[model samples]
Structures are given as C-alpha cells and as structure tokens.
Target: MVPMRTIAHCDLLPDLIQQLLESNSDTHLIVCATRPEFLLHLTAAIRSQRADPDTAASHDLLTKTIGLLARSSKIRLAFCPTLESLRAYLAVLGANSNESTEEIRSRDRQLLSILDMVAMHVTTSEFSAQGLSRTLASAVEAAYSAGMDLRLYECTNALDPSSAVWGRKLWDMSVPSLNGSVRMRGDESTWGGRGVTVKRVAERWFEFDHSH
Candidate 1:
C-alpha cells in the first residue's frame, strides 16, 4: 500500500468550499455590497458552460458550488439574486431536452431545496422586507449591522404585466420608492392601467446599506 499524497490542485476545491461555508457576517456584508459584480461573474460562468453536457465532473462542480453557497453567511442576504441566477442555469438545462431526465430532476431537487431554505430564513428571521423598498431597507440594515459601507443603485423596467402589478402594490406598501420621477410608457401601461405609470421599485439598492 502506498501513501496518498495531496497535490495543490486537489486541495483547491476543498479550500474554496471551506472558505465559502465558513463565511462570516463580514463576508455577507461584502457580498451585499458587490452583488452586481458577483452576479455578473456567476452569469458569465454559467454562460461559458451553458452548452456543456452534464457530466460527473460538471455535476460535482455544481454540487460543490451550491454547497458553498448554502453555507455562506450571504445565503440569506443574496437569496433572491442567487435564485435568479440558479433559475437561469436551470432554464438552460431545461431547454436542452437531450439530457437525462433523472439527472435533471436530481439537480432540480437540490436547487429547490436551497431555495426553500432561503424562503424559510426570510420568513423566520426578524429581518423582513415587505416590498421592494423594505427589501432594500432591510438589506442596508443587514449590511450596516455587519459593519460594511456600500451604496447600491437600481433601475427596473417592469415590462411584464404581472411584475408591474406587483410592483405597483409594493409601491403602495411603502416598501418600494415611489419618487414619482420614474415613469412607464407604451405597452407597459397596460400592465397596471391606462396612463397609470409605474414607479421605480428601488431607487436605493443594496441588500444592506451602511446607514440605518
């Protein structure tokens, strides 16, 4: 029997996994602050491999990535944004019907579990965001509590009727900023009503801003 040697590359994945899992409040603050850049990285990574067939190596990579995300302190803070990314990846898989159904289903189950955990955290925690405004406000509060100073700016176009309706409701709830400057035009007006403009769901962004 020969002794097994650990190479640097062999340790890389595990090290990354540990770091992500052991992420602290400070880590969450950083994630909240640089969410856009983080998301862009995630998107590019996904797009780069979108055409690759699901293999054992690919599955392992995804599993490790998801595990890291699950254990990260930023999990709750970045839940929605992360979910959107996951949804995009899953959409790619879904579009490729050639893949094994069993494999796809298994991956879907795992993703759904992660999503459920996020929803549960939001529901159980004292940190709550009612609508877009409250959501941004809570994010800022969370970041500040974590001792991070960051600013976020968001511009959303509510083209979908469903999204516009919900956006309007969120606006009324005071969770979203209705500064009365952002306006909806053209076919978008049919979403809520004729001449009933939509407001910017988020003027100030960031899962958590430093200012309370």
Candidate 2:
C-alpha cells in the first residue's frame, strides 16, 4: 500500500513534493493542519523564501509542484483539518492579542477560499455533536459541489451519544474510510459492529468503512 505522506509544516513541503514527483504516481499526500490558515502560511512561506536569491529556484519548483498536485489524477489533494482543530482555532483566535478581530476574520476567509480551491478531500474535526455534524455536512456538500470525493474523516473511538449519531450518519453516507483511529483514547464499543471494518494505514491512522 502506498503510504499517505503528511505535510505537518511548510518547510517539509518541498522535500515531499520532490519525492512525489520522483516516485510512483500513486503517492497519497495530505496537509495535516490544525489551523485553517495553514495554506495562507504556506503561501507566505513560499513568497518569503522566493525573495532570497539562494532559494528562488525552489520557489519556482514549488509553484510547479502545486500545479501538478492540483491536477494529478494519481495524487490525492487531501486536507485533514484535524480533530478539534477548528474549535482550538476558535479558542485561540478569541484569545489572541496580536491581531485584531477583523484582520483575523479576513485571514480565515482567505484560508477557506484557498482550501476550496486546492483541496479534494477535507476531513472534519470537532468534539461537539453540532460542530461535528456541521463540519462533516459542510465538507460533504462542498466536495459534491466541487465534484470531488468525500473519503476521509478524523478518527474517534469513544462515541459519545452525539458522535455515535455522527458516525452512523457517515456510515449511511457511504464514506469509504476515516483518517485516524488507531490512537483512539476511550471505549471501543461504538466502533465495532457486524458490518463495520477497520484497517490500519499507519501509526494512528486507521480506516473505518461499512459493508455496503
């Protein structure tokens, strides 16, 4: 199986891109970001590096890489918003004193726009039932509108009442797999059932699918 490589930081992107271009066309890549503004940060990083004469060539390469990644059929342009990441962002934003509210809001808007433009699969995250449902449903609707596939989700094992409902809903939607579950921290009761399937993809990365 082809391993799904994650870009946890912007600095790691260039090397990952090179590997993808040089390796088999079936490489799966995901931007595992806790912040919604990760793409903006990535762009900023690229621009800052491009200003330096030494790294200018890399900037051009990164641009080309982004283009290829966007259009490649063999590559998956997936984004994992990360479990509770959205909520954490909200909390941090509320407390952050460095930026004004309007500035932050504008930045967030840009992040969402960038995400819509580049992401093929976006994993939903959050612990609240309402938040989980909203994010998952919104991502699904967005993917459908963009003619993309909804195949990834952040993992959870202990399904509180609400999470269980969300999981059942996902099963009903026929989503093929989830992104993380191997490191699930609580009861496993809700995850095991007659028709459910769990497969380990990597450390902390598990797939939960239902029998169709």
Candidate 3:
C-alpha cells in the first residue's frame, strides 16, 4: 500500500502532482496543512503571478493541473477544508466562468466528487431565516444538480429558531436524495422528531434518513 503524502506549502502542490504523475505505483494523497485557507490565497497568487498572456497561460496551466488530478487513476487526491473556507472557495467557483458549457459541466462533475468527499466537514448553523443561509442552501442545490452525495452537518443551535423553518425548507427541496446528520449542542427535537427517523451515530451526532 502507498503511504498518504502530506505537504505544507501551496507552492509545493505542483511539484507533488508532478511526482504523483511520474510515480510507477498507485497512491492516495492527503495534503495536510495547518492553514487550509491558503488554497484561496494560492488561487489569487497564481493569477497575479504574471500579466496579460502570461497570466492567461498560468490560469490554463492551473486548470489543466486540476483536470489531470481528477482524471489520473494512479493518484487519488483529497483535501478537507473548514466549512468557512469551503464556502469561500465555492463562492469563487460559482462566480462567472468564461469556459464553454461542456467545460463547465466537466469541471462541475469533478468538483461534485470533491464536494462529496468533504461534505461531512461542512458545518453550519445558518439555518435561521437569513440571507446567508439561503445563499448556502442555493449552493447546496447547485451541488445536487451536479450529482453530489451530500452528507451535511447541521450544527443546531437551541436558542436560535434555525431548524424550525429550515427543516421545512429542506423537506420542500426538489432533489433526488437529501441525507445528512446533525451535530447538536442542544436538543434537536425541535426538528428531528418531526417525522424524521434519527439514528445516533455518536454523541451529539445523529443521522437522518434521506428526506427526498
């Protein structure tokens, strides 16, 4: 079995990828770092690395590198970012894309897989009737469209009327399957006991059946 590789600096990503591609044996990579948010900074850094044609060339190179990672069978790559960092990254991704429809779809398909791998790490108490919650819900909806197997983490807040409306909102969502587990600091009965079968996975974490 190949040992999982871990790296600290974002500048090392391309080098790691090159090594993985060159290796004769299969491997799964897990690039651990104290500051996972550096990924967003890396994106910005790559863009500003040059101007005009050079910037465009670097952008294409970055895009192709990601595409290569996704397609390579010899190397399985995965990373888990905090919910906040993931949200920021997803927002950047959802922004205007100049690529073709096919290219966009292909990228989304690859992204959907990565999203699935990190779905459980997505913690949110933004279930309250707020614009931000709605924005996050919209992102979730888009992920569903891209064929993501989302296992969400709802950090239910007892004092907040979060689960009240959001539970109903989730129930009304049009998707093939909506399944998630909740990490509760307080009683989640305000929503969990409402026609949902809750199976305890661990302390404070309960898995709910597929709502759709």
Candidate 4:
C-alpha cells in the first residue's frame, strides 16, 4: 500500500478541513488521518472544553490550548460561511458594550471555549482566497475598528510565520496585533519585560520577509 503519510498528505488534510467546517460534531472526528499539527489543534480543543484552570497543569493546558487555537489554521473557527449568519453568530458571541469587566471576561472565555470547537482543523487552508471567507482576522479588524487595543497572547511555541498551518488570514490578523499597547513588564508574569512579543513578531516578520 502507499505510505499513509503520502496518501494522507495528498487527500486527507483538505477533506478533513472541509468536514470540520461543514460537518456536525458526530461527523467531525471521522477523518482517515490528519497532520500532526492538526491533531494538536484537535487535542487542544477537546482539552479546552473541560479544562479547569485552578491547577497549574490545567492552567498551562488551557493557555497552550488557547495559544494553539489562536494560530493560523484554527482562526477561522471565529467566523462562519455566510455573512448574515456570521453577524448573528458574532452578536451572540460578543459581550455587550456596557457590560462590566467581569462580565466581559466571563463571556470572552465562554466565547473562546466555543471557538475551540470551530478551530480544530488541518494546517493548510484556502479560506482566505474564497469569497465566503470568515477568519479570526475579521474579529481583530473589528477590535481595531472599535478602538480596542487588541493584545498579543502568551505561548511557549516560537511563533512561526513560515509555517503553512498558520493560515494566511490568521497570519494577517496576528501580525498587525504586534503594534498594540501590550507593553511587557519587569515581572516575568506580565508580558515579559517590555513587549518581547512585539519584538518577536517584528523580528519573525523581518526574518520571514527577508528569507523569502
């Protein structure tokens, strides 16, 4: 038989992404195989669903999970195929403007929880080229449009702009986010000493741009 990776690499990834976008929960997990990076996303999604962050293990798990979901391949989970449906769905996901900070935090976490499901898919995508595209970038765009200081996230993974899985739209959304007012602090706990992430994003982009 042909090697599974060769076969899977050829056919499985695209179909898996399609099913994930188009199918219901029962049908989503039925792929013949998937990319390892893709599997990491699925694992993160499932883990995020029941993750209890009171413990360090659970906290790291959910934070990593969110970071993975924040990557390029999975960012489309934030959107829908149709405009009317997307707007209605986003209205449901969004916190009310006048809501308290606690309410917004609670609601955003819940929204991220739901996003975990939509995001579990393969590394590669053509969603940006499609006319029906919806992406995490759209939300970032909306945040900027609303004058919100969209913040960069925490991650142990070196952000890879070169990776194929970090889909185009997500790459776009995440890159511009480096410019936000997310200053790093002296304490390692908060943003890590003067926006190291801003520097990382800039340097990564610089390297990627030059390397190309």
Tens digits of lDDT, candidate 2, 79-182? 44654443343334334436554553443221111121112122332222333344444434433333223344322112132443222233332222333323
Global lDDT of each candidate: 0.30, 0.35, 0.35, 0.29
Once fitted onto the true fold, the runs of candidate 4 whose alpha carbons sit more than 4 angstroms away are 1-87, 91-95, 99-126, 129-137, 144-148, 151-163, 166-212
Tens digits of per-residue lDDT, candidate 1, 137-167, equal 4444433332233333221112222332221
lDDT of the structure predicted as candidate 2: 0.35
Clashes of each: 7, 0, 0, 2
Write down the TM-score for model 2.
0.31
RMSD of 3: 16.0
CA RMSD, predictions in order: 18.4, 15.7, 16.0, 18.2
TM-score of each: 0.26, 0.31, 0.28, 0.23
Per-residue lDDT tens digits for candidate 3, residues 43-158, read 44444443456545644345566656555776554454445555554455445335655553454232222221121222334322232334445455534443323233221112
Query: In model 4, what is the error at residue 126, expressed in angstroms?
Result: 6.7
TM-score of 4: 0.23
Model 2, residue 18: what's the lDDT?
47
In model 3, state the lDDT of residue 96.
38
